[model samples]
Target: MKSSIVAITLMALFTKSFDPQPELINKGNSWNKNPVIAHRGAWKKNNLPENSIASLKEAIRLGCYGSEFDVHMTLDSVLVINHDADFYGLHIAQVTYKELLTKKHPNGENIPTLEEYLKEGIKQKKMKLILEIKPSKNDPERDQKLTDRAVAMVKKLKAKEWVDYISFSYDVLKRILVLDPKANVAYLNGDASLEKLKADGFYGADYHYSVYQKGEWFAKAKELNLTINAWTVNSAEDMKWLLKNKVEFITTNEPELAFETIRAVQSGN
Candidate 1:
């Protein structure tokens, strides 16, 4: 009986240690000054191809807090960065990385492998790489593989310090936690409640701006001490509303305008 009790005690302790509190994630890291997260990097204004290294660098140059990018695994198991499942009409998962590379970004850069993206992102320490692991269309197995490969690569590159994760796929986010419980993860599907997120070991609620407007999610998020981030918010008016409500992060294509709105809001202008 004593031996069984001891085993149970050990299991409980192990579980407690593994499930990290949301507040303690990224404990020592100092993020950028403002809450602006450049959506697909700062690509819109310069017309740079989204998910290109050039665009990632531009977000860093702009001093945004985080630059969001998408990741998908190729048929040959190489992980590459691109927003959509299809790259120039070829489905990314259906082709090998080499075939995908035959096409280049409008800027002449090839679709960056996850490793290449991480290496460039780690050059500076101020900004974060907000990696969104895109789910496979209808393949749960592929989705799991993608999640596993992405996490393994991040660990191998030691980029965990510079990377946080966002995903529309709840399973992907959950798998991330299983791999690294302390990872800063947020949900992007905009359907899960903040309470559900917090209970499920998520660090934040990254919903669309419209999702928050329909309910009392903003207030609930604040009360629960959950990080609140809204995505692709480009309008100045929407920016002002989110800023006035004191959201922690705003992912936007118009990061420069976000900065301007942040300044104006701070000054009560």
Candidate 2:
């Protein structure tokens, strides 16, 4: 657990003391600032189709505090969740939402748009967002446009208090800042230092566990005011240790297991 003072100070930085909305303190009710964000919208083990609404709902049912998903724009301008630039075989960016809707999962479920998922999931609010803005090295401009549209929609929906935007591409994150200065931005793929992050104006840092090798960086993130969230953690031992340190978020493929573990610990059972 984070020291009370540290938690208070960190919360104050991201969320003002007078904001009136409750802090998303992950004591037991909500997710930690560094939460367990389900990868690919919490797909069922059987379906294995990432970014499906079915998986998202199943994650919720399992009491996952938050979920993360990819958001790409359709040619006609809809924010849908899919990892690949193309859906199955077709390039999703070139297709309209209606066109993408025509495609079906192996289980016959429909592909979900970001907006649809957000609206559907907002009622729960337990699952905060870690919206990753995917930019291709080959087509950076396309990434920017997709990011801009997603940022605009998020702002229009007034979900600032609920979502954090992250990306490996620095430009994509910068674009989000331009769209919403207060939008929480975390630099994915931890390679830079706190000094470097502050210089770059990044609010947080997220790196893979293999790369998250520095115990010192955790405190460094706290001191530098860069919120820390690690990714794709699935081990019980690692999860326990990180929780002990109060690492803000734990992105994972096994959200159901994570939540169950969190519940077990919280309930003192």
Candidate 3:
């Protein structure tokens, strides 16, 4: 009896050592200087290929608050990073991961898998990984599968805190909340009202820059205490407008210019 008890205790200890609980990996990391989120890493000024690891690194080097990238699951259910449904004329959902990797990005980097991207992202503690899970408009089943797999991968890697999710599909974002209610999820479709978003439990309303201009969304978002973020705002005028309104985040391809604009606006130049 004594020998059996000792063996059981030792086994429990070993298991605990190998299987630790998931916790925030970047718990105390400092907040970024500005609200600029690199639209697809920081590729434009440097001529690097968007969604490539090189661009992600550049965003980190530039000290952007976050770097947004898109995720799509291949036919074999491997999550790869890119901005479009078709990569270099190969339909991503129809091809296997191995086949899709045959073509190199314009910068000569193999299109990065979601795992590879997250690994690089977790290395630093500052920049948040704004992961946009691309939706399959024609196939709802595929979207759910992609959502499940993406969330599972993030959990498996223990990277929950380093990442935030955004999607144009309401179902996909809802599914994310179902899977991880504590997740920082925002809707990207731009049609939902602030009240609707708050009722649906979204972290924020991530809309096109024009969406805010069309209505009283900026004021309503503040009234409802919902976070506000505008996407793809590359022009200086639009950046100034969003910054002046005090939106929480601005997704832009021109992060360097956005920083300059932020300085100018802050200094009342």
My TM-score estimates for the predictions, one after another, are 0.89, 0.79, 0.88
**What's the ranking of the predictions by TM-score, best on top?**
1, 3, 2
* Higher-lDDT candidate of 2 and 3: 3
lDDT of 1 by residue, 186-249 (tens): 9999889889999998988888888888878767876787888898899999999987776788
lDDT score at residue 5, model 1, on the 0-100 scale: 87
lDDT of 3 at 6: 82
**RMSD after Cα superposition, model 1:** 12.4
lDDT of 2 by residue, 162-197 (tens): 677888888898888888876777788676776887
lDDT of 3 by residue, 25-82 (tens): 2356664646789998999999999999999999999999899999999999999999
Worst ten-residue run, lDDT, model 3?
A: 17-26
Identify the runs in model 2 with alpha carbons over 4 angstroms from their true place: 1-34, 45-48, 260-269
